[model samples]
Target: MTPSHRSDLLTDALLHYSKKVERKQITLLPQRLAKAAKVKEEARAEFTALLQSVPGTTITAVRGWGEDLVNSLEKTSISLSWEEAYVENLHQLELGRTQLEAPRGGAQVLEVVKRTERARRQVDILERRHRVRQRWSLTTTDSERYLTAAMEKRAQAVLDSVSNLAFERKFMCGLMAKYAEGQTIAKKLSRQIHKLNSKIRRNVKLYNLKRPVIPSSSTLPTLMTFEIAMNPESGLWSQHSVSHDAAFQLKQRLFVLLSLHDRASEEMNIIKRPVCRVRED
Candidate 1:
């Protein structure tokens, strides 16, 4: 055969092989695409099923397809809405306020008020004695000195008559009893508040998780944490009724009186250190 003829035959053979390969590839293309699509669909479905099985799974750790599906599942799984939890917490807080504000025995309150007034008068008398002593130190005349001494003696006599140790002891005991009662109530309320706050946080977290496109108007204000709500300066107290304020003030007074009692007991060496049963507020 001629060289040109041989080259032409080789070219025709190569063209035929190329056409056969192209046809084979075109014929298999749909099957390959279908298999690939099936694999993709299976992976997505499997991932979705896994998400559904473990609804509590942290989304950040999940690195795969179907993030939107996971989010949808989360939203659907929320048992309690944030708004409902918030309202429940507010109701619990109101109840606590009411318990604190409820009136105690009228006789006990009257006695405490009367004793408090007498204590104030005693303080005033002591202050007058202190001023008289200062004046006595400055006096130059014997007559003035004699007058100051008589005044001091009379003041001491009045103080002796007014300052009844037994009565004071009874008053301190009453304060201690009130303190214990208030502490118990406060602790119970604090625990309830804490639990409610925890519930609120959990509900809020679940509700907000992977939530898409929340509107500005629909967004709720940030609720105060337990610590913030308990704080005197948080202004949370001002929103409550006057009874709540009075209850708070009463607690403060009880705390102060309890401290004074402890100090007195220590100074007198009559009682050993009192064992505190409750944790400090």
Candidate 2:
């Protein structure tokens, strides 16, 4: 065989082998691209599910959840103001009584009588204004005694309600703080995950790499994983349990208080009934 013929045959063989390899690669290209796309889509769907599962995602929702509690707390605060005013009124009433009863200097009998009458009138005015004549008067009617007792009961109810509300308000405040902290953590985690996903997608598209490589810790910022946040050993879960227990305890206390209030109300109603009189012939 001639040297030129042998050279031509070898060249043809090499060219055929290269063409076969290229054809094989072309045939597999679509499947590889489809697999990569499926993986990316799965990652995106997982992240979306995670974000949806997180509670209190919107500020409006958070605010709305606490709105009723806030209103109750505000209403309960009025009891404190009312109590202070009642105390001040009592002090003023006492001061007026002292002034009315104070001894006057030596004077004529007519002058002494006029001063005593004036003091009696002033005391009467104060008694009417303060509406405590029933409580302060030495001679009290049965009806007046009943009214005084009712007022005292009502005042006690107000104080109890205020105390319960104060405790609930404090618990709510702590719960809200925990919620806010969780929300912040959730937002930060979401941002980090999104950034990581974006980085992977960009790297894959730009380099046409078969597998996306995660940068070393030294090169990239560290991310907190969902697994860590949800782990039972973490502080987040422990705090959740603590809050849940506290809420349960508070609920029990409220139930007990409500039952007691109901019982007290029923007793008051019984007390308010007219007494029955039996005649002995």
Candidate 3:
């Protein structure tokens, strides 16, 4: 019925949810997955190292060939890294869930979990790039190949750069979306806190007038409400209030969320370099 009681109830519920998340995260893959991933990374690195031994790599004729080899290594690295990322993702998820169950651990755990999710999305992009590269390599013509080399001094440069740009754009888009949501929340909380202040001032005015006032039976605000509010945001949220003894955690959560929003905004606003172009011959 009180703020503290509500927090206790929410804590129990969050612990239960965290346990479920832990169970999901602990779902194991075949033992061979880790070993295969390690071996693939090592092999890719070794092949990349072998590039230094290939002669005439600087020459146009040989450069394309070298590019092909380098691309192959990159593709392998992308594929292997994408697959291996899940291992850490799941590990971090479990760790995050454990932390989520602990007192006042929500902010840190949410950060870790959201980061793992971001890593997974990056892998998704890599997977798509690998597919696109494979498709293009099959269809590239001699003229296109020449243009590629002339524009960037490496046949694969355009492809790699295009892929990188695509990835960056996608990442920026994601940040923009997050920033929008954070802005909305910051506005909402600012309003709520403002409203609370107004209510407190009115209460004081009423008490000073010596008017008999009936207190509302509704439970007071709690840190748990912040968690409820942040359910959609799902990253770095703490249900526990920021204090020597926890009471109102939403203010702290809002501060961090707004800060994150500002950082994303700055990144989104940066000017990107122009894409390489080939002049008509």
Candidate 4:
């Protein structure tokens, strides 16, 4: 046969087989989508857990700060010029404006306002510190360094998980390619066996004088010459070759599945965070 003829025949056969494979893929699509969704959900849950496990939150307590500011303005009140108020309003505004450090202004409102100001100095303190004030309200922005370091480490872990998911997606593409190639190889092998058997049936008399001619469908690789000569071989050679090709293709399918399995196994390697250690390993 001409190369073009062979190519056309293979293309037709591949179209048929590929349609069968594609049908199977269609059925499996929902399964793949479900599994991928599960993986993503699990990763998100772990990310949430990591966020919660951190000592302080990224979200600051700013609403309390606003309320405190309002209270301070109301107490040591400063009113608008359009206001028609009594002397009490002026006294209230003067009281509100007094510095928190003043000798007479060590009241509850002033103390809370100072603590609120200190807490506002760093959001991390606002998150981690439950106490508002004490004998004194003191804060150091130096505490900012530790908060940044801890947050950076957790962010890196989250990014690592994202990378693992990307790698898993790429690895799955390899599986798809491997199965595609295996299908092509199997189809070609089936046709090759079929042609070889047909040739032997037509030309057996040319290859052997003593041997009786065998039929095209009976001369498979596994059949014995005596079986063919005695007419004991059934005309199932093509079917048997198809079965062998299918089985070989099954092994390649399993190999592709195993590759995807490895990606799932390695997923944990990306999400784990190291605990504090006194010594480096």
Clashes per candidate, residues 3 or more apart or on different chains: 0, 0, 2, 5
The candidate that wins on lDDT is 2
lDDT, residue 233, model 3:
28
Question: Comparing 2 and 3 by TM-score, which wins?
Answer: 2
The TM-scores of all predictions, comma-separated, are 0.21, 0.22, 0.18, 0.21
As for lDDT, the candidate ahead, 1 or 2, is 2
Global lDDT of each candidate? 0.40, 0.42, 0.38, 0.38
For residue 151, model 2's alpha carbon misses the true position, in angstroms, by 4.3
Clashes of 3: 2
The local lDDT score (0 to 100) that residue 21 gets in candidate 4 is 73
Per-residue lDDT of candidate 2, residues 234-257 (tens digit): 443343233224444433333333
Displacement of residue 210 (Cα, Å) in model 3 is: 81
Residue 174 in candidate 1, Cα distance off native in Å: 77
Q: Compute the lDDT for candidate 1.
A: 0.40
Q: Which ten residues in a row have the lowest lDDT in candidate 3?
A: 272-281
Candidates ranked, most accurate by lDDT first? 2, 1, 4, 3
**Top TM-score prediction, candidate number:** 2
**TM accuracy, model 1:** 0.21
Error in Å for residue 112 of model 3: 50
Error of 3 at 270 (Å): 30
Model 3 agreement with the true structure over 160-247: per-residue lDDT tens digits:
3323222223333444554455687656655554554444344334332221111232122211222232232222122212121121
Which lDDT value does model 2 have at 58?
Answer: 45
